[model samples]
Target: MTESVQQLVRYTRIQEIVGDVIRLRASGVALGDIAEVENTDGEVSIARVIGLDRNIVSLQVFTGGKGLSTDATVRFLGRPLDVVYSPNILGRIFCGSGEPIDGGPLLTTDRHVPVGGPTVNPVMRVMPSRMIETRVPMIDLFNSLVESQKIPIFSVAGEPHNELLARIGFQADADVLVFGGMGLIFDDYHFFRKSFEEHGVFGRTIMFVNQASDPLVERLLIPDMALAVAERFAVEENKRVLVLLSDMTAYADAMKEIGVAQERIPAVRGYMGDLYTQLAQRYEKACDFKGAGSVTILTVTTMPGDDVTHPVPDNTGYITEGQFYLHGGVIDPFGSLSRLKQHVIGKETREDHSQVMNTMIRFYSEAVESERKQAMAFELSPFDKKLLKYSKLFRDRFMNIRVSLGVDEALDLCWKTLAECFEPKDLLMKQHLIDKYFPDIAEKETG
Candidate 1:
């Protein structure tokens, strides 16, 4: 990386200060350039040049511009935002500004990589084929996670999105985990850290958190820092890295707030016009390197008012390969999908895996119909009664998010649940599988 040039400009005349924005008359100020504002009390704060029109430049002060006057000075750092990248970054906790808040040793390396770097070239990206098993049947058996695939968990506010993310962090088949938490509450942060420690994966996980009490401007830095470190791990170290971001809605809110402060025209739902481009810039970072490790992104996008049309989720749906709809605390199989799962499901898993997945879903769908029939007090067929029983078993056995079953064990349990509910002929499976897995249910049945 080339060394960043420091412009070192000082402007004392402040024209306007409104909502963490400082406007002044300055020349040669480039957009995205870092700035330092020294108040009259000799205290300095960091900022970045967000807008420049004619001789007027506007900087978004990271300190929220609490107290300022014409006596304040601004220095334009020639480079955009940056963070240090090294192996030492693992197992460390940093604030949204990429500074260690855990009182740990400062980054000893002098190497600085700019944040929000460009996406990888399509030519450099290999087709993703490997599966990332989390041992959750809903994901492993149904929507298999593929390496380098960008996907999101569509959920609402009260859903256990964070807990689900932490669960994946604990169990995902990755060499490293990078978690970026934006606008998170203190209790949520504590929960994540404690859960990681209890699960014994905290040592391999790196956390960058922007708490609710932190400056909103800094919330913009979490994704960049998390992705920067994860990219370094995947490229330099050749480690399979999984990046998990919670509540991207909060990040979008931060962007909206900053845009409002900048006086930019709002787009749909008061979001910026560049929403898609900005979001793609980050999600596109998920890539599978040709002979190296991959970086897979699994983010949580909380839809406001549970509306999928909300601008944040609406724009996100276009960028991601598929989504895991997390409704009612369990991953709704009807709503969740893995577009890339086909690349690895049958090719990587057992032969019976695909057949079992289809059979179970088919039965589950029929079970839903049976439930409707029962609700309307219609006459129930023997098969419908069986489906009602199977429905309860399926939910308790598999759909329950709390059920912790490995992929292989979950597949075996599917056969167990089927044999207990219906005869082998009722399964509508291939005769070979029926004979192989489903023993004579009649003989096993108690009179």
Candidate 2:
């Protein structure tokens, strides 16, 4: 053997096998090191070191250990997993294992970069003051998605959160889109691909998907692979990268399953105690490089049974900047918030943007109260009838997830809805904006 190949280490004994994990006595092995396991039938599979004792290492096999013998040969790779990073990867799709599954030519191995590195330092990160306009009125006008912000779409099953995610991916003004989907059905996967293709954004998009039928371990790798590539693009290429991850709940579940397989103690709801740490390690990747571009993360976190207190979303709420609450086929403005909106609302947007957002939400809240009163058979007041009219317009124009409009257009629609519902004097807005925005209303009153 060559001198380089002679230095490789191999072990042919397996101490124990449980679920998809195998335990063996091996010295000089670090956690997260990749190992190639060749079964007795001459079939090779991948495994990663998940635990380490004094002289024993526990590896989680990528391919489940169903028929493997105890004497399967283990070859340590002395490195963690990595993904391909190059401009050629654009418009390509890869599996969670970082292999090209789109029938494309195999990429050269020279550009591989390791995944799951420490996050950018605070001093290297710039303040998130820029806005990423998705053209979704509810998000752009109300809860603006700021650059380098990490947020999630809080939803339940059967909601169109995936559609909303794809819409933002294609519509958001970013230089590149990195999408990661975990445990998605085939149809949903096809839909996203078709959406990006039809909207002409596929050329600038890179997808890392793990379907429901794929290996569960691969689900855990999607976020890391996607984010790793995104970070490279933002720093190396100096491009604004938007990363959209769907169903982070599935990723957490995969971790729990692996934890169970390893016989580790479970935390709240059968999850490992380090759930928050693992999630933060990935989410902290969102950063605006000081002299380069930015990476913005928007993920879909489904709350089981629509329970906000569920561990996954409950923990996510504390880590993310804010969440876009997707319920009842729309983004509930009351439940959704952007804590960083103050950074960009009036700075990047129009001067009237802040006042318009505040006024629209206030009237919508009153409209909701009017709806409750009407439902209770209470006699509605004259102004309550106007509020009822504003509510329907707000839903159809802004709240519906399908409604897409620029920030200025949505602000104009807000003014139009308010003007059609009430006279200029009835509007409790700043006199300057009211008169400047709708001079015809003021002129009629003065005349």
List all candidate RMSDs to the true structure: 2.3, 2.2
- Candidate 2 runs further than 4 Å off: 1-8, 439-447
The parts of candidate 1 lying over 4 Å away from their true place are 1-12, 108-110, 439-447
Between which residue pairs do clashes occur in model 2? none
TM-score of each: 0.95, 0.97
lDDT for each residue of candidate 2 in 324-399, tens digit (9 for 90 to 100): 9998999999999999999999899999999889988998999999999999999999999999989998899898
lDDT of 2 at 418: 79
RMSD value for candidate 2: 2.2
Clash totals for all models, in order? 0, 0
